[model samples]
Target chain A: MSPVHLEAVCKLYRGRQQLSWRRLLRPQPPDPPHIALQDISINLPKGNVLGIVGRNGAGKSTLLKIVAGTLAPTSGLVQVAQPVAAILELGSGFHPELTGWDNALLGLALLGLDAGASQQALSDIADFAQLGSAMERPIKTYSTGMVVRLAFAVTTCLHPEVLILDEALSVGDGAFARRSFERIMQFRRDGATILFCSHSLYHIEALADRVIWLDGGRIVADGAPQHVLRDYQHFLDQAPETQTPALPQAGLARGHAALEQHRIPARLRRIRVNGQPAGQAVELTCLQSTLRIEVDFTSDPSLPAPGVGFIITTPDGRSITSTSTIADGIVIGRDVHGSGTVILEFPDLPLLRGLYVLAVYLLSEDGLLVYEELPQAAELQVHSPGPELGYVLLPRRWLPLGNGHAAPDCKPSAHRYIRT
Target chain B: MRGVLLLLRRLIRAYGQGFYQPWQLALRHRHLLRQLLGRDAIIQTAGTHLGRLWLLLGPGLQILAWWFVFDAVLRVRPMARFSFLDYFLPSVLPWLLVQETLSRCLSLLREVRSLYERSIFPLAILPLLPLLLVWMIYTPLEAAVVAILHGPQAALAATGFMVVLAWLLLPWCYIFSLLGIFFPDGAYGMRFLLTLLFYFTPILYAPQMLPENLQDILAWNPMATLLQQLHGLIGLAALDLHHAWYPLACSLLVTGPAWVLFRRMSIQIREAL
Candidate 1:
C-alpha cells in the first residue's frame, strides 16, 4: 500500500473580515472562504520522493499540511498507513521559556512516544544536533539555525513512515544541511515516503523523483521531474500570456526587404548572433567571454528615432538589467526612418551558470512609452566549470594568510568551505 | 435503565475516544509534561528573589487587603461565628483557583498556537497544561493555609473539593479556550465578568448578611454553591445539600455537551490558527 494517499482534497479558510461599528446591531454575513487547495488528489508509494513547486500562496504548504495529517481537508479522504512527521516551520512546536532539552522531550511525546522512550531519544537528538551545552538553554536564546538543527534531528531520528519537509532546510549551516540530506537519503533507503517542497529548483532536481507544479490552488502539471520542470519553466517564462500565439512569418533577407515588409510599428522581426540568425538554442559561453545580441525590428515612420531595448530577466520575471538607445545616449539621424537593428553586447559577463531569459521591447524615442514588448524573446543557458553560488561570479586572487599573517604556502580551504 | 446504559455506552465510545487519546498521549509523554511544568514553574519566579514563595505571598496579601477593608476600614461584621480572616481564607482560596484558571483558560488558544503548528503532535492535551501549572503553584500554599487554621480535616476537605472543582472546570476551560481563538478579546471579557462574579458571590461577606431575595439569587450562582461547600467543609456553614446539587447539576449539563462540541469544534478551530 502507498504510505500516503489523498483523494479529492480541498481546503478553504475563512477570511478574517472585520465588521463595522454600524453593523453591531445587525447580523453580519460571514465572509467568503479562500480556497487554498481545490480538489487535489495524490498518491505516494513507499520510497518515492515527491517535490512540490509553486509560487507563494499557491497552496504548496497547505498540501503538505494535509499529507502530514496536521490539517483535515474540507471534503475528502486522506489515508496514511504509517506515522507521519512534518517540519512545517522551525521552532514551531517549541516553547520559548523551555530549554531545548525540555522542548525536545515534548516534541517526542507529541509524536506518541512513551516517557522512557522520549528520554532515551534525547541523547540521540542532542548528539545529532551537536548543540552541546546550548541544549540546556531556553530555546529563545538559540539561533534560528540551531533550532532547525534540533528540530531536524528530532524529526529524522523518530523514523517516521511518511516525512514531509516544507522549506524546512532553507536555514541551517552547510554541514547540517549535508547531514540532513544524508539522513533523508537514509530514510529513502528504508523505503520511507517523502514530500519535499522548496522554491529552489536545484534541490528539487537533485532530490525529487516526481514533481507536482501548483498554480493558484490547482495542479498545472505533474510528472517526472524533467518533463514537469520543463513545462513549469515555460509557464514561468510567459505566465502573463496564457497561450503562446504564433509569431508572424517574415522575409529571410537582412536589409530593405526584411525592413520595408515589416511595416508594423515596434515589432521584433528577428534575433541574430555574430551575423547569423540565432535559432532554437542560445548558449552563453561563460568563460568570462563576451556575447552579443542583435535585435532586428520595424518602427513606424511617424515615430522617428524609436527607442529599441532589451531586458534580461530570470524565469520568474525578476528583471535583472535593461538597456535602451535613450539610456545609452545614442540618437538615430533623420535619414534612418523605416527599420533598424539594435545591438546589445555584454563584455565578459559576470553571471554565474544558470538559465536566463531575454526580453526585447520597442519604445518611443524618449523611452517612456513602451510600444511593444516580446517577453522571453530568447533563452540563455550559461555553462561553467565550477559550481558557483548566486547570479554573479566575482574575480579573486589567492594570497594565502597563515596564522594572521600573509604567507605563500598556506591555503584558505577552511574559509572557502564556510561559504559552500 | 437500559436506554441510559446505551446512551452512556455511546458517549463512552464517541466522546471517550477524544477524552482518552489526549490523556493517553499525556501519560506517554509524562516526562515531557514534567519538563514543561518544571520550566514554567521556575520561569514564573525566576526574576524574583523569593521564587515560588510568591504563591503564598500573593494570596496572603489579598487576605490582608480584604481584612483591612472589611474589618478595619468599614468595621463590618460579615459573620458572628467566625472572624473575617477565617471566613475569607477558605472561600478566597477556591475563588482564586477558579479565577486564575478562568483567566489562563482565556489565553490557552494563544499559548497552544505557539506550540501545536510546529509538528504533527496531537495538541489536545495542551489546554490542560495551564490548569496543571496553576494547581502546582497554588495547591501547596492552599494545603499549608487550610492545615494551619482549620486543622487536618479542613486540608483534606479542601484537597477533595479541589479535585472535584478541576473536573467541574475542565469542560468550561475547553469551551472558553475555543472561544478565545475566535475572540481574542474573550480573556478581557472573562476578567471583567469574573470580577463582577466575585462581588456577587459571598466571598467577602456571608449570604445571610444580604436580604432573603438576594440570598435566593446567590444560591443559584455556581460560585456561591462552591463557596458554601467550602464553608460547610470548614464547619462555618451547614452542608446544604440543595446548594451543592445546583452546581453539580449545572456542571454535568454543561460538561456533557461541551465535551462533545469541543471534540468536534477543536478540529476546525486548529485550522484557523
Candidate 2:
C-alpha cells in the first residue's frame, strides 16, 4: 500500500477580519477564504522521494503541511499508513531556554517516544547532534548551526516511516548538510517515503526521483525531475524583472490607452511548441535543434493571406534577425478567417546564450501596412551549458593552417551534447 | 431504534478508543511522558537559586499565606470538629492541586502548538503530564506532611484522595485545553471563573460557617465535595460515603461529553494553531 495518499485536497484560509464594536454587536459575513490549495491529489508510495518545487506562495509548503497533518485540508481525504515525522521549518518549535539535551528529549516525546525510549535514543541523538558538553547548555547559548543539528538529530534518529521536510536543510554548513543528506539517503534505503520541498533545484535534482511543480496553488507540472525542472527553468527564463509598470489611480483615466497598448494583443494568444506551453520563453536543450512556434490567433475575415513577420533583437534593441512571409515568398493560397493558428518552423535553429526580444507583426496581404505590431512580444532565453561562449555555434574546422603534416587522421568525430 | 443503536455503538467505540488509546500509548511510552514531565520539572527549578526545593517552597509559601490570612488575621473558627490547620491543610492542598491543574491545562494546547506542528503523537496526554508533574512533586511531600500531622492511615487516605482528585480533574482539564485553543480569551475567562469557584468552594472556611441553604447548594460543588471527603478521610469532618460517591459519579458522567468534545476539537486545534 502507498505510505501516503492525498485525494482532492483543498485548503482555504479565512482571512482575519478587523473586529470593531459595531461589527461585534451585529453579525457580519465572514471574509472570503484564500484558496491555498485547489483539488490537489497525490499518492506517494513507500521509498519514493517526491520533490516539490514552486515559486513563493505556490502552496508547496501547504501541501507539505497537509501531509505532515499539521494543517487539515478544507475538503479531502488523507491517508498515511505509517507514523510521520516532519521538519517543516527550521528551528520550528525548539525552545530557546531549554538545553539541547532537554530539547531533544522533549522533541522525542512529542514525536511519540515514551520517556524511556527517548532516553534510550538520547545517546544516539547526542552523538548525531555533536554538541558535546554544549548539549547541557541552553539552546539560546548554541549557534544557529547547533540548533539545527539538535533538531535534525532528534528528528532523524527516530527513523520515522514517512518524513516531510520543508526547506529545513537550507541552513547548516557544507559538511553537516552533506551528512544530513546521507542520513536522508539512508532513510530512502530503509524504504521510508520522503516529501522534500525546496527552492534549490540542485538538491531536488540530486535527491528526487519524481518532482511536482506548483504555480498559483495548483500543480502545473508533475513528472520526471528533469522534465519539470526544465519547464520551470523556461518559466523563470521569461519571468519579468522586479520592476513592473505601476498602475495609475482610478481617477487618472488619461493616458490609459498608452498602458492598454502595452498589453499583448488579445487576438493573438497562446504560444506553444512541441506540445509544451512555451509562454513567453522557450527552452531548447541543443543549440542546433528544430524550433517550432505555434501561434493561435483570431484572424480578420476580410484579410486574405495576411502577411506575418517576426524580428529577433538583443535585449537592448539591436536587431539580430528578421523574417517575413512576404520576403520569404511563401504564398498563403487560401484566405482564413475567425480563429486560426500559424506555425513557424525553424529547422537547425542557431542562437546564443542571452536574453533576446521577439517582436511580431501582422501585415496586410500586400505587406504595405502594418495591421498589428507587438513590440517585445516575448523574451527568448537561450541557455546551453558548456565552456564555449559565443553568439552562435558554427561549423568551422581547423585544417592545420599551412597543411602541416597533412592534418593526420582527419575524420568525422562523434558529436556529444551537454546534458545540463 | 436501529439508528439509535448504531449511533450508540459508534459513540461507545469512538469514546472508548479515545480513552483507552492514550493511556495505552502512555503506558507504552511512559519513558516519553516521564522525560517530558522531568523536563518541565527541570526547567521550573534549574535556573532558580532555590532549585528543587522550590517544589515545596512555592506551595509551602502559599499555604502559609492562607494560614496567616484566615487563622491569624481573621481569627476564624474551624467550624468543623477539628482545628483550623488540620481541617484546612488536607483539604486546601488537594483544592490547590485541582485548581493549578485546570489553570495550567488551560492554554496548554497553544503552548505546545509549535511542538505539535513538528511531530505527531497522542496529544490527549498533554494536560495529563502537567497534572502528573504537579502530583509527582507535591503529593508525596504533602502526603508526608499529612502523616506527620495526622497518622499513617490519614496519609494513606490522603494519597488515595489525591489519586481521586486527579481522576476527577482530568476530563475538565481536557475540556478547557480544547477551549483554550478555540477561544483566545478562554484562559482569562477560566482564571476569573476559577477565582469565583475557589471562593464558592469551602476552602477558606468550613461549610458550617455558611448559611444552611447556602451549604446545601455548595454541597453540589465537586471541589467542595472532594474537599469534604478529604476532610473526612483525615478525621477533620464526618465520613459520609455519599459525598464521595456522588461527586465521583458526576465527574465520571461529565467525562463522556468531555471525551466527545476532545475528539471533535482535536482536528480543529490543529487548524487553529
Interface RMSD to the true structure, each candidate: 3.2, 3.5
Q: Write the per-residue lDDT of candidate 2 for residues A73-114, one digit (tens) a residue.
A: 889899986678787766666777788888887787767776
Candidate 2 lDDT tens digits, B17-54: 64555567568767668766776676678779877788
Name the weakest run of 10 consecutive residues (lDDT summed) in model 2 chain B: B14-23
**Candidate 2 off by > 4 Å:** A14-24, A81-83, A112-120, A158-160, A189-191, A237-420, B7-22
Query: How do the predictions measure up, each by TM-score?
Result: 0.72, 0.71
**Candidate 2 docking: what grade?**
acceptable
DockQ versus reference, model 2 = 0.32
Worst 10 residues of 1 chain A by lDDT: A410-419
For each candidate, what's the DockQ?
0.37, 0.32
Instruction: Please give the distance, in angstroms, between residue A368's alpha carbon in candidate 1 and its true position after superposition.
Output: 44
Model 1 misplacement above 4 A: A17-23, A240-420, B1-32, B42-46, B72-77, B185-187
Quote the lDDT for A390 in model 2. 57
lDDT of 1 by residue, A136-238 (tens): 9988898888888898887777887988889854336433554576677778788888898987574687678999999888998989998888787766666
**TM-score of each model's B chain?**
0.86, 0.91
lDDT per residue as tens, model 1, B224-260: 8888888888777777766688887776666656666
